[model samples]
Target: MLAELKELFATWIAAVAAAVEAVMDRLASRRRVVLQEIDGDSFTARLGSVAKGAGLRPVSFRLTPHGRPEPPLSPQWRAALRSSVVEVQMRPDQVLFREVDFPKQAADFLDGMVRAQIDRLTPWAAGEAVYGLSPPQPGPHDRIVLMLAATARAKIQPLVDLAAGLGAASISGVVTVPADETAGTTIRLFNTRLAQAGRLAISIPRLLRGLLIGGGVAAAASFAVSAYLGARLDTELQDVQQRLNQRRAALRLNQGTSSAELLLTQRKRSSASSVMVLEALSRALPDSTYTTELRIEGDKMQVVGLTQDAPSLIRLLEQSPQFTRATFFAPTTRAAEDPGERFHIEAHITPYFGSGS
Candidate 1:
């Protein structure tokens, strides 16, 4: 049993090492083509190394924009470009460069800090742009300054798709500074890898559309279920309202003498109901203010309250459509015994149901 277990472990170890070797080989052996965009749409293609800083070969092959067959590709050139990593270099004019200074503590979170400010720094949101940053260097006042390079994704996506159509293994997008700079600065904006660039671009949109369609279906189903359950409750409420209207109609028919009834109706119209006055006060008072006592008589309402700012309550009540002519009935006072000032406020209650009197 021990010998069998040992053999199994050896097999697993071998498999793991083989996987690592495969990944390293893929990284080391991948050939790169740097497409130097010229004349706004055309590119000068040159072969480059996967090794860092080896740079592109000096020999140049100019390729025209799509939809033109000015120079046909030889089978050898087609084979060379097939399944190679393509690097699309944007001209300095195509990119927007901005210098930003951040506190030294933000070094580790530079990506997030820059992303949050992308909208402020450029015309596009973070998600809508392909962007990169220079290495942070010492700046004034214990800060670090980093150069941000960005361009609209829409502007470069067509170029990416063009490379992918040529059977690229992966695609990398970059932008460089003008030759006048002391040192050439190249910032990589985006990368799509794993010899799947072509299929990936098509699949991403399909995936996003599928997710949206599924979410909409789920929301509709939930709404239907809730509406089904609430139908009976809505019917019951309608029935209750109908019975109330019938009862009021019968009471009006039974009331004696039209003149006497008209007098009572006039009094009712002028009266300030406690419920309405309380609701009005509740709506008028600030969240920090609370009343200890409330009184409603005829068209007047008086509220005795404790508040952080007692004087502001008068203006608040006066501004409300439910009350008018609001003022202080008594002095607002502060005492050591209480946490807030005690206030006596009076406002005339408007009898208009939905309209200000």
Candidate 2:
């Protein structure tokens, strides 16, 4: 059980690692292409420089307002733009900038936070404008300061469309920086795209595949456990049934009969017998008393007879060891033709006198 759990954990970890590596590789393959809008009429294009170990050099180009080649780009520039991730810098007047202070904890969610503040900081509502922010800078007290940049979606969409028409693989964003400061912080105005919006869609199938594998493993383990428990319970039930059968067999061998038959015989011997009760009554009653009807049910006996002295019969029956609690059930009366009174007596029969032993 422990080993199976360990294997499952290891499998999940490996799956997660593989998914992370795949996403990282996809991001690394994307090239950064920058375009700085010089004026409404012209723009400068450049390939962002690669890191030291990358063994690549930067290439630059210029394009007219109509997207016609100014001097004609080299083969490398054309190739780079075709597969590159594009970013366009808008002229300062074309974009709006605002400085806002927020809680430190909101740093991670600045894009959404800044978007919510767009209508308050600018004339445009959040949906009407395309907006982005600079990296948060430390502020007074515990707050953070950030530069928010926004432009009308109408103004930004044309540039984005142009970049796409020029064969850029994806548009990264629009940025704005102060002209005087060479190292001025750039604030992004828009970065969201249809493809980037659904980036996680690529990982959905991979995640589902992993979940299915894990679910299958769990189901198989559960089935194995259920089968094992069912077998164990069946074995236990069989063992109990076998032990009960053995006990019954031993009892039959010792008693010379099945348990039910032995119980019936013993009950008959210990219970009241009609014949034995009659003999006991005969000895208890006077000669003048004669029984006409007698009935025995369970431990109770009833007698109907003609007696010279009906009341005396109760005392006589109670004194006998075979009967108890004797009493007249019917009123005693002298009959016109009979020599004695008609009487009915009821009593409990004792087990001792009826036992054959």
lDDT of each: 0.75, 0.74
lDDT of 2 by residue, 98-125 (tens): 7788999888878767777788998889
RMSD (CA, angstroms), candidate 1: 29.1
In candidate 1, what are the lDDT values of residues 62-155, reduced to their tens digit?
Answer: 4444422135545555566677777888788878888898999999999879999999999999889878988888988999987888888877
Top lDDT hit: 1
Model 2 residue-pair collision total: 0
| Model 2 RMSD vs true structure | 17.4
Off by over 4 Å in 2: 1-30, 40-42, 49-78, 104-109, 162-167, 174-176, 179-183, 192-357
Pairs in clash, predicted candidate 1: none
Scored against the true structure, residue 153 in model 1 reaches a CA lDDT of 80
